[model samples]
Target: MDFYELVKQRQSTRAFDTERMVDREIIARILEAGRLSPSACNAQPWHFIVVDEPDLKNKVADATSARLLGMNHFTKQAPVHIIVVEEKVNFSSGIGGLVKDKHFAFLDIGIATAHICLAAESEGLGSCILGWFKESKVKELLNIPKNKRVVLDIIIGYAAQPLREKRRKSSEEVISFNTYQ
Candidate 1:
């Protein structure tokens, strides 16, 4: 499919086919997309942790869900969870970030997350990028270091839900010719 069509078709898949499992090769391809993403000064301040083992993935899924708040309850249904970790930026990127007063690492990771999602779509799979979760619990479960930060959790699987119409603001509402409105 074309890139625009792929973007239109890609949605935050909330339901997944638990009976099916995503292939490891496909997962590697998805990860490769993220790895190839550009970063500020090539710092590449991120790491991806793949949780595919059935029992462990379930535990990681539990860390991403909150029943009381009704968020990410369907994460367990997805067979794989990729945890994004934030790492220290290189000297040049760090200096640039300080000079601009911007968190470039987060921005780069966000781009990588988009690449991963698009790759999943290209591979005929569904994905959801989750930010709200019990980060400390996930760290314990995955044996991630205390000093490290968990940036995002992406769940991938065969979508059980159908593709719904996408609702968005009009171009005029978000775009400007040359100056702020």
Candidate 2:
């Protein structure tokens, strides 16, 4: 699908078929999309943990409270969960001082997450970006170092239900000609 079409069709899928599993190659593509995202000064502070093992997924679900996006129980049933984290020490700091920009890491991770979601939609897979979680517990469970911070969790699988339409503000309400009202 084209970029516009993918953006229009992408929706947060909550209900997923437990039996359906995403192909490893497809998952790799999704990860590559994230890895290729642009970052401040190309710091590339993001790291990913792909959890496909049932036991680990279940642990993440349990630690995430299983109610991340309202009553979305299928989040726990997804065949794969991609955890996105940001490293504190920027590897590309030698180019400049991108590491000093503390908030840049989160921004970079957000861009990467967006790429992953778009790629998943393009590949006919369902996904949901989850943020509500106990970060410390997740870090411990995932064996993430203290220097890295969990930014987002993406659940991937085949949808079990139809995509639900969400409400959005009209352009007129959110846009301005040159200045804020």
Estimated TM-score per prediction? Answer: 0.98, 0.88
Best candidate according to TM-score: 1
Q: Count clashing pairs, candidate 2.
A: 0
Per-residue CA lDDT of candidate 2, range 1-181, in tens?
7799889888988888888889999999989999998987788888899999999898887766645455545568888889988775355653445436457777788899999999998999888998877899889999998877788889988888886776899898999988995
Poorest stretch of ten by lDDT in candidate 2 = 93-102
Model 2 ranges with Cα > 4 A deviation: 66-72, 89-102
Error of 1 at 85 (Å): 0.3
| Candidate 1: regions farther than 4 A off | none
* Model 1 lowest lDDT segment of ten: 64-73
TM-score of 2: 0.88
Clashing pairs in 2: none
**Deviation in angstroms for 71 in model 1?**
1.1
Q: Give the whole-model CA lDDT for all candidates, comma-separated.
A: 0.96, 0.83
Clashes of 1: 0
